[model samples]
Target: MSSVLAKVDWKSQGFRYFPLKLHYQRLFATRVQKISLDGGFTCPNVDGTVAIGGCTFCDNRAFSPSRRVRRDAIQAQIERGITGLRRRYKLEKFIAYFQPATNTYGPLDKLKTLWDTALEDPRIVGLVVGTRPDCVPDEVLDLLDEYAQKTYVSLELGIQTIHDASLHWMNRGHDHAVSMEAMQRVTDRGFEVSLHVMLGLPGETSEMMLQTADQVAKWNPAGVKLHNLYAVERTPLADQVRAGEVRLMELAEYIQILADFIERLPEQIVIERISGDAPPKNLVAPEWCLHKGSIIRSLTDELVRRDSYQGKNCRMQGLPREPS
Candidate 1:
């Protein structure tokens, strides 16, 4: 009998199967590592550029598994993170992931010193900047545009959802159109963009998530991450979850939601991550999805079990997905 996932043809489907880009095999081809660096940058929400308080659900401690969050210097943080990373695996090079409070929410003059210091390190192979859509400006994008010419520069935008109501409920400063414009602007700059979206947000449904994914696919980012919302302890969303004001998605429900999300992509956008990797230590609700590897594996099995793959809809329309 013929099977759908039999060969796991990422190219045949017009989009790389979520499994290919979502898996570790491609992330660390030869056992590379992610060195988390804290640029000590503040957020607009806290700095008075946007809302007084940050997102209701935000607790960056929940993301960025990198251990160098508190390190004072960027070079020290990178070196320490790299040395610590060796305890886990043996990799000569690493992707220095700038994953802290708004990485670009600062003056450009300071940005130069911070970035130049990190690049001076010899072990760093690539750079990944994680920031909010509202944080990055045109000049910063131009800086990244120039950097991409020499090194692999990955810009990750934390766009939790496209639904305005959900954005309001989550306290994300930017709206749907802002996110789209930000993505289009950055994508047009030639620097690779890795978008971050979440599922199971307040007042969001399967349809809303599909809509979010549809819009993200249209942006055609190099990577799209769909994660289920995790309400960390002490966050506003956590209080809501405790008081029954908010809801969480079960692992199975989340898996189904993720599968549906992959179906909506334009077939060319790479599905970098399919779920939020909220560490269990800070996580409060839906503890099951905290284990990223297990969630990914389970999601892969479900996709295969359903006899489906990424871009199932695109291939039907005779549209070829662009290479991400």
Candidate 2:
């Protein structure tokens, strides 16, 4: 198996798996981890500006750390996160990740203040601001563009799926067109863009999920996070799961779907994550998701078995030719 792993130049493969760490190292010349922060942010959808209840499948608390409450001051949380991460990894640097809720859905000055505080940390070399596509306005983009020139600034948008129907079913507040416009503007400005795409929403079939990847390939994101739909407690999705209205994909089924999704993606895109894992205590279904590391290893093994890598099926799907 080690020989099989060696047979492929995983680094050179057009569609590589889990390439973010190496990509960061090439730029920063050091190891970096994301220090997740809760910015005490809220979504317009949940606030009645758009619609209520947020996304059907979303329960932000599912993945948020228990110690980092939303009420904590931004710098206080960062201090704690730095201490925790440094102790665990002996880390030298980190990117402050604004991951909780819709991180940009706030007053412009407040937004600037939160980000400025996080950026003020000496150990934080960059900012990874995660937000909904619809939430990022021209003002937010302007701020992010300025930061991009000074340090490693990345805008992580949750594009979930390219299908409007799926967007609607998920109650994502904005349509696919909104995501397209936001992506175009962000990438055009030369800021590194990373997008979030979910594979197995309730109504999607394997073919439909792969189609989403094809659409993402056209955008040519700098990084992509592939997530599986897992039922979490206290979300409408959980109710649907309980009512037998929706079915989550089995673990093996998700792995195959993920490989197909990755193959359709262009090689230049750094895969930030292959599978999504909710905290075991918060996860309501698909117990297999708890074993994230094992799932990633299984994915690499499957790729080896098939003698395939990220973009082996790209041209076959009518995607742009990989750069020589």
Candidate 3:
């Protein structure tokens, strides 16, 4: 490794155990929490701008904490989210995260108005917008770029899977090419970018999941959010699971896949999430998915058992550096 990369204080820097959570602190010199704000945005696929019924596995309400929908005002949601998060975490600064739907799907003026409203609170130190690849346009990117100059900003694109079959299966409005193009545009403009991927998607094997990792590494994103596929009630995926057309990966199987996937990724890539949990009331299968704490412990134990760490076998090899 170059002396620059070798000098990273992995242990003290928190990369030895978990790198993603601490990445923001290291950059901003304090704990910066992300407050998920529902901006009442809709996806092209859901609105018939692309397709009709939305993604197969999607039910936006399932992922939302307060079950926030389009009717809720952005400011009220942020205030409520901040109050709860502050009481629990005692955090002072936060990033306004526009999560759930296609955050950048509207016109530049409307998008800016929402972003400005969310950022109006002085406590908010940054902004992170999550949206589909096809939803981002030059104007949206330009708006995000303007924010980049002022505060911490990251554009999280939900790329899900690189395989065409999986993309088609999910009824994602765009193809892999569009995702690549979106990523390139974000990176080329020197913006911090993060991508989301799901493991154990129907028909994807361990090898295929790792292949997605390989492709992601080549793109060199600043962060990644990894999730395990789980069936939720009232979604098309749940129907498929009930019909025995889809099989969710068990807890142990998902742990192994996650550990292996992390090893294959470049060490510098911040793991924004290891796995996702669906509310018990909304979940239909893979009962173990609700055990977040146990899963983390098991994952830590597995890593220790193998005496391995993130980037143990990256596609682009770098000389191992001692953890500080």
lDDT of candidates 1 onward, in order: 0.72, 0.78, 0.79
The local distance difference test score of model 3 is: 0.79
Alpha-carbon TM-score of each model against the true structure = 0.86, 0.89, 0.89
Best by TM-score: 3
Write the number of the candidate with greater lDDT, choosing between 1 and 2.
2
Pitting candidate 1 against candidate 2, the one with the higher TM-score is 2
lDDT (10s digit) by residue, model 2, range 99-130: 87888777788777877888888988888888
For every model in order, what is the number of clashing pairs?
A: 1, 2, 0
Candidate 3, 50-169: lDDT as tens digits: 887789988854332233344238777888888999888978888899887788877787778878887888988888999999988888898888887777788999999889889999
Q: Which stretches of candidate 3 lie over 4 Å from their true place?
A: 1-8, 12-18, 60-72, 317-324
What residue runs in model 2 are displaced by over 4 Å at the alpha carbon?
Answer: 1-18, 60-72, 316-324
Error of 3 at 61 (Å): 7.7
Among the numbered candidates, top lDDT falls to 3
* Per-residue lDDT value at 205 in model 3: 84
